[model samples]
Target: MGESLQSIVNLVDPYTLQILVNIGIAIVLALGLNVITGITGQLSLGHAAFMSIGAFTSAVITLRTGLPFSANLLLSGLITAFVGAAIGYPILRLTGDYLAICTLGFAEIVKVVFLNLDITNKALGLSVPPARSPIPMPIIVWVVAILSIIFVCFMKESRFGRALKAIRDDEIAAEAMGINIARYKVQSFAVGSFLAGVGGCLYAHFLSYINPSDFGFLKSVDILSMVVLGGLGSIAGTVFGASILAAAPEFLRFMSQYRMLVYGGLLVFLMVFRPNGLLGGINFTDLVLRAIGRKPATAEVNERHRK
Candidate 1:
């Protein structure tokens, strides 16, 4: 089945296939940010820094140690997670804008460090190996993306998730309930940063080149936009938003110089109408039934409970 799928994919135009792969990579990054900012309610702006670290780490591993791509992926994520824990420990206490400022500052520092690194060629960047997996690049990207979504969904339904939710909704109350706020916050960042590193692996492999400039402050803002556009705490929404934003530039290219203007306009329109997200709080089954002049039994039960 995998071979057949790969063969079918091989028939697609290379440029279009690369775009699809890009969408998958964006989804992974958005999901990671969703964990830190959405699920855990911690505002993080340094996500792109982690991605930069992952790309360099994996590329270096392959160039120096000649490790397989899979090992590089895992190792890169582990290394980034350790960095996240160490950095997260110091600044996790600040709330609101203060936390955001600290994270943004940290992101710039990482970028500057990468720029001066001899191994990275100091802004010249490094060439990365393409996907060396037994499976095709598209298939592997899809598998990783799907598995990430599933894992996050499951995590949201676990006891750890409940604690995170409480922390998000009411930090003081959560602490009163005996939740370890500091520990949980750091752990959440570690998990989120690990995923960001994995995403960097996919992204670097996709482009075959990466530099410090590639993961700058603007890149971090773009990622944060994906989460906000999708819906905070909404995994499916994040995927939806990432896919739309990823493809929007391609579709809007025909507008020439006005393309970005139109793109920004569209995001503003969506936020005005569906502030929660394009799919947040929406159940397809219930939506379809409502459109057909009927309602699902669960919908009726929920309405009754609300009353």
Candidate 2:
């Protein structure tokens, strides 16, 4: 009993706190990815590129302008959103594997650009000052993540979200119904990129160091893994997926050389058993309403957004 109590006390340790921060950041990333890949049915493998842009943008802002953390976060997100809007307009024209390949190529281009840029310090990376935060890092991270999740939940039920879903479900049908496919797709990409930028900003500030390699192909894959592991369209699922994947490496530390093998095997096993994800098409919003003894609308409850 005493050991159990002692164990709980260790949850606030620096290492644990850092882990918490990582999980929160991952949740934020996954939330953004869901907007594109999950809801809009776009396959992107360059999410980390957007993240890197935000990281560098935030670092530069902090180092040069002396802005506070919140301002930097907002500015970075807006900048990334603009980039996404401009790039997504043309890139989102592709679909399926073609879209994935283009986005992946775009990621490599971003990485190369960052690696050559003098302001980013080239290959050596950038050392950033910590955010001028009013509260603890974990609190700030989780607060942003939680607010992002809530906003997504509300967004999911909004007309914009429904249009994205319609596009995802049947793009031709949606176009025939008068929905502007190109516009909605670009909007989704921009919004998702904004969230990814915010996540990257938080990550850079939390670690006080970042580099181009940090947001490479593998990092994009990792974020996608979280969204996949959780139900793709489910916000609650992103939380679960991010938490589990973020803590997985630490928990597997004892395995050393074999940890990655085990991790790969675990993901394979989960996918084989649950192809649609752990909670695919299961809306937590409906679950919440039911939990509180107020049944959600029949259409809402019956909605299945996952493909």
Candidate 3:
């Protein structure tokens, strides 16, 4: 019992805790992007750019001004959202391949700027201040997770979400119904970007490192893969997908050589066999309870139980 307690204590050390916190932040970032690209049917290949914006802005503010973490995070998110809205005004007007190309180009531009900027240290990377207290990681993770869940729930039930869905189903019909399509799209983009910015801020702090290469085209592709593999527009699926994708490489460390190749092949097979993804847009929680012969509420059972 003493040994076990010691082992558990070791696991709770500052570094390990920070890692878990960073993972939580990653989930938020991925989920926020998932909402925009997955549920709302917006295709942005430049999400990492927005993330960089948030990270750099937050880092600069926190490092230079010595502001509180909350203030830095909020300001960073807002700044990133503003940038997103500005970009959305023009880019959201394009659709299909046109939008994809534009976003990709935008991402490239951000990368170039980061690499060439004299003040950004030209790829040497920026270091964030060290965390102050023990259990900081857990505190940050819980805060970020709670905020993300709240925001997601708000968006899911809001009239805005319904409008976005309507537009996704058929933009022309949504517009015909007098929905302000452009406004909703831009709004979604800004909200999603803001969430991504928050995630980035957490990431920078956790790693205590920031670099242009961290937010590259491949990073965007991996994020998109998580959404698609999870199932477009499925919230529960996003969680499962993100967890799996994030942990896969680590879990398959034994595979060593062909780990990624195997992962890619499996993805291809999934696309062929289960295009909707492993969960089929179904919530894992609901599926688990159903498998054990429990339903949410059946009328016959309710009436008989009452008797």
User: lDDT: which candidate is best?
Assistant: 2
lDDT of 2 by residue, 83-202 (tens): 999999998999999999999999999999999999999999999997876555667788899999888989988999999999999999999999999999999999999999999999
Q: CA RMSD for every model?
A: 3.6, 5.1, 5.0
In model 2, the worst 10-residue window by lDDT is 1-10
Give the winner by TM-score: 2
lDDT at 177, model 1 = 98
For model 1, the stretches where C-alpha displacement exceeds 4 angstroms are 1-6, 254-267, 282-307
Every candidate's lDDT: 0.86, 0.89, 0.76
Clashes of each: 0, 0, 0
TM-score (all chains, Cα) for each model: 0.88, 0.91, 0.84
Taking the tens digit of each residue's C-alpha lDDT, what string does model 3 give over 1-307?
5455436546686655644665577678777787778767888888888888888877777678867787788888999999888998889998878887888899889888988887666788788885433335456656787678667756765788888889878989999999998999899889889988887787777778899899998777767767777777776677667767766656677885875577678789888999987665574444545889877434356888999
Model 2 residue 243 CA deviation (Å) reads 1.0
Task: Kindly list the per-residue Cα lDDT of model 1 for residues 201-300, writing each as its tens digit.
Answer: 8888878899999999878877887887888888878898889878877887777578556657767987889877777764434544688999776778
Report the lDDT of model 1 for residue 78. 93
